[model samples]
Structure formats: C-alpha cells, structure tokens
Target: MIIEQSHFLFVSLYIFAISIGGLLLNRRNIIILLISIELMLLAINLQFVIFSVFLDDIIGQINALLILTVAAAESAIGLALLVVYYRIKGTISINKINLLHG
Candidate 1:
C-alpha cells in the first residue's frame, strides 16, 4: 500500500483552511487567535515536509525547520504579551483592546 502526495497535500490544505476560518470567525478571544496562527503554521510545515519527501529534496525540510523556529518564537512572544495584557486588563478578550487608542 502506498499513499499519494496529493492525499497529504489535500490534508494540509484542509488544515490550512480550518485554521484560517478559525482566525476569521473567532474574534472574542486573543488566545484562540494565537492558537489558530500556530495551527496554520503547523499546516504549512506539514506541506513543506510532504513536498520535500515527494521530491526527494532537502530544501523543503530546511524551510520547514526555519518556519518551525519562527513559530516557536512567535508563540513565546505572543504568550508573553498575553500574560502582560491579562495582568493589566485582567482579561484576554479582544473587546477591550480599544484601550490602546490613547
């Protein structure tokens, strides 16, 4: 039995679509936005690895590693900001973000 590259491609595309939908549709919480972004990155990484394996090329894998590193850093920074915002505002909801207008 063998799995085709298009199968993995379609799976990754589906994941990307869900993540985008989550980001666009869920606007009440900041945490969910960050999570959706992470999921999108994961989908991208999955696509990179799938293509890399299918093409027998290392460049795609390397790109995936770089993206993984960026995702980790982004998550860390995002969490730290969330913590700070929560401490000051005592809530992680995006509705209160209008306070930044000052």
Candidate 2:
C-alpha cells in the first residue's frame, strides 16, 4: 500500500509540475498555449485518479473520464478562437490582442 500510494503521489506531483512549467513558458506561440492547456488537463486527470485510488471509489475514475471530455471540448473551442484571432490579426500573440472597445 505504501508503494502504491507513493507512486500515485509522485505521478500527481510530476503532472502538476509539467502543467506549471507549460503555463510559465506561454508566449506568442499558439502551440505553446495549446500544450500548456493539455498539461493542465493531464494534471487534473492525475489527481482524479490518485484520489480515486486512495478512496477506493469508482467515482474518481468516472470524474476523470468526464474531465477528459471537458478538456477536449475546451481545447477545441480554444483552438477555434485562436484560429479566428490569427486570421483577423495575422498573428497569435495574446499580448497584442486588445479587441475590447471602450
């Protein structure tokens, strides 16, 4: 049990670290943004699994599946938005976007 629990903790922490790193590295590159989003999703999934294992409950697994579906939808929407932005501005820099009109 100790080994299994430790493994779960290690995996969860690793995923969290990757997600943080990805977000920190976000830049004008749309690909990096997408990757960061993916890493964040992966981290959530890892936590769900770890908790599910710790509690010996199926709900965690179910929640993890739901999270994956949501993540996919989010990525699709985000990519679509990025495409629209790029088409309009000819660049994907988040810093340059200021479409809000006062």
Using TM-score, give the best candidate's number: 1
Global lDDT of each model? Answer: 0.93, 0.82
Question: What residue runs in model 1 are displaced by over 4 Å at the alpha carbon?
Answer: none
Clashes in model 1: which pairs? none
| Candidate 2 lDDT, 1-102, residue by residue in tens | 347777877887887788788778766776787877788788778888888888989998999999899989988898898888889989877678788546
Positional deviation of residue 62's Cα in model 1 after best superposition, in angstroms: 0.7
- In candidate 2, which residue pairs clash? none
TM-score of each: 0.94, 0.81
Question: Candidate 1, residues 1-102: lDDT per residue as tens digits?
Answer: 788998999999999999999999999988889999999999999999998998999999999999999999999999998899889989888887877787
**Worst 10-residue lDDT window, candidate 2:** 1-10
